[model samples]
Target: MPRSKRVTIADIARLAGVSPGAVSFALNGRPGVSEETRQRILAIADQHEWRPSSTARALVGSRAGVVGFAVNRPARTLGTEAFFTDLIAGVQSSLAQHRIGLQLVVVPDIGEEVDTYRRWRRSNQVDGVLMLDPRVDDPRPALLRSLALPGIVLGGSPSGPDDSATIWLDDAQAAHTVFDYLVGLGHRHIVYLSGPAEFEHVRLRSEVLAGLAERGVTGETIITDYSPTEVATTMRTLLSRQDRPTAIVFDNDVMAIAGLRVSQEMGVAVPTQLSLASFDDSVVTGLMHPSITCLTRDTFGFGEKAAEYLLDVIASEERLPDRTGPRPHLTVRESTAPPPA
Candidate 1:
């Protein structure tokens, strides 16, 4: 047979001297076919190098053996962000176990992300999706529900009536852990450098700073684009302040590293005059001169669990309860200590 030519169930059935229904039953692991007949049909299928076509699977409302994952962020950022890279690797690991394909895409913004989902559903492009970075009044959840699409929210709580399940991290609790650690070190004033305020996780972490006054701790949260240059600039301004914060917490490891460089340039000694920490950690965190303190969690496991949960939702065809993943823990390092007396 010409390699360009396609093989179908009928072709396999004819070659195996069996009916097409028997071929279907054997291929799908149904009980209608005898064991001997099933083995013969399988041998023919293997000989022809036959595989189910995605188009045919979609048309028949069967498993496409694929899922969609979209990120509404700049492509350049994804390249430098270890968090996403680890998460994606974890997702791939779980998907590989079941031999499922992952369709990954990066869109300019949320609007385009929604458009992509709509198109995918209309064309039966995927059996499900994994949603990330939930925003205020996010339209993706309700849209997924309306389209009768199964999905899993990666980091935020689901809004509106959606059959989608959620895998969430306790951002507020993590923030408190950082605060307690810093405050216990006699750092009365702290600064929180965060990502865009629109992100639900960022908002949760920011909100925790509002109540710090009750404990005689002065706190300030500065929102930024999470770029190195921006973080450096913010650090310059903060370091120049008459009453600079004794400790600073960053939403990501990249920003913390940038802030550390700025501190060094300003003749400030880390953990002696200033301290730095990050909400997320990576191998880079440990490689730094002072080995910056940070909150550590299994980002890869997060993605793996997400893939498993979303697959389950698709298979069950029902809404499931939200799942809370492991909370990040503070890993103290050379970057944090008691404020200089």
Candidate 2:
């Protein structure tokens, strides 16, 4: 068999119509080449499956221009999440400007999420990472520090004022805003259908509601694990029982949609029958029949910030990384209204 031609920088440079040095800088994600030229070279490299050679590695090293994302969400949720799709889009959008690739790897299960990061850090497989679905008192941030890994935490630990780059979303405030809206709408009894138990933000959202009840709010709450297929059954149980919640706030879009289905099945009228709101207002919210009232967050922006921060962590040496977005709040739709008399 005739040996396939070895892929080389010259092949890339010739195809991209740039000098070999420019190709090197472009492929390395180094400064000096314009973003336009960098993209051009990358496209040509992709066409040929061209990778940096050992000689190139000897000079520049085998750093793949790829960012890994480790998410704790279940395969079912991850497969359907508009937030993941949009977030990944934003990250890819930002990284593509520099010819960086995105390597999205879902942990086999929640247990594997943290271990994925640990293994990646040890292997030096990615240029950086985007960590999502944070857990309270998460050890990953400290792990990153201990390993001197370069990356960004999305909506997790506040990247220390002196710590590594991290994006901390005010998850408590987001839940509070949505709940307060429902409360003002006369939803005294509220049910919070939460995400996986280990997620920190899910816990925080639940905690905020729990604390609100202690403050003399006229509301009752129930918490449960999330799965779309089972929600109809759960909601039926909740509906049949006395003292059922008048309003529901979901920690995710999937649960909110599930709640809607359950309400329909039990002949419970939306708005008139039950009020609803959820966080992470992605396509599911907008596309649903009643158009779920939900917390308005810039998920795409979150991904962008996560990517930018990771880049900074890899490049910058000064100041705690900071980026801001509009605070997430309630985007009322037809799904929520005062309970029927």
Candidate 3:
């Protein structure tokens, strides 16, 4: 038997009892088609294994049909961070639905990250870019706006030109929740193992911790690179102090797990001699010997929504309102408890 002909948009339209234009709008995720009709058209296309050809996509004036994601972190550290892994998975899943690709790049610092965006824009390598690790005086947003590039800020407020949108988490509220939880557990002497101070989220968390000083809770902030080695060293230094904290909170799972190891090596029992909590929840937190209490959020869903918003910016000229996703919630586990007597 001969192979069947490839399915076309017209065939999809005919089968769905819609026009070719309606099928185009549905498949492209445009606003013209109703949600029910869009689903039906998508179902038919999926059944037929139909995909838009690169030629067709380009003919519609779509440049490159790819999105860019650049990060300013050590490659090794990024490799161990499950948060980014899950986030990228969500981003790819959403972009795949639109038949778009993701261009991922890792830079050593914010300067290089800015340059990466400039290069992507100059070369037309991506339809838009996703910005992460936003800072107080971030220049990338302005640069992207000056270039008239469509971009989305992943975890910070929209500070760029009107063309960009921001999908941010409520970091301040999350910090408050964690702080209140720790204080309620009788942990008065606390130390926050944090990421670099330049990050906006880090600053916000630090501020929240500082506010505890007024309430008679002694809170100390120690900045680290979120690397296991740095975190271990910081943990050991703080633990060796004459007035060591009864509880320590780490900014990420990698550092939390390392702190746990350092505590064990130094003969400090977790949740007995010292309590530990992590900011970001990951697989290692739950599977470790003493499950870590940490702040958990839908990182995957965050990525998906960010990608969807960026795609919308690419598809239209209207400015969309900035979106805020669900805030991170504290998930209690074995790692956190009342300080030892």
Best by TM-score: 1
What digit string (tens of lDDT, one per residue) describes model 2 on residues 243-330? 7788888767878888898898888888788887888687668888889998887878777777877887777665455565446777
| lDDT, candidate 1, 248-304, per-residue tens | 999889899999999999999998999899998999999998999999988999989
How many clashing residue pairs are found in candidate 1? 0
lDDT of each: 0.85, 0.73, 0.83
Model 3, C-alpha of 178: deviation from truth (Å): 1.0
User: Is candidate 1 or 3 superior in TM-score?
Assistant: 1
Candidate 2 local lDDT, residue 337? 88
Which scores better on TM-score, 2 or 3?
Answer: 3
Indicate which candidate wins on lDDT: 1
Candidate 3 lDDT, 1-341, residue by residue in tens: 12287788898899999999998787765789899998798778756756555567567666889999998889987779888998899999999998999999889998788766655654356889998877877777778877678888876444455435789887878888888898998989989989988898888888899999888899888888778999888888988999999989888888899999999999999888888988899988999988999999888988888899899888878777888865678899998888877
Candidate 1 Cα misplacement greater than 4 A, ranges: 1-61, 156-163
- Candidates 2 and 3 compared: the better one by lDDT is 3
Clashes of each: 0, 0, 0
Query: lDDT at 314 for candidate 1?
Result: 91
TM per prediction:
0.81, 0.77, 0.80
RMSD, each candidate, Å?
11.8, 10.8, 13.9
Error of 1 at 319 (Å): 1.1
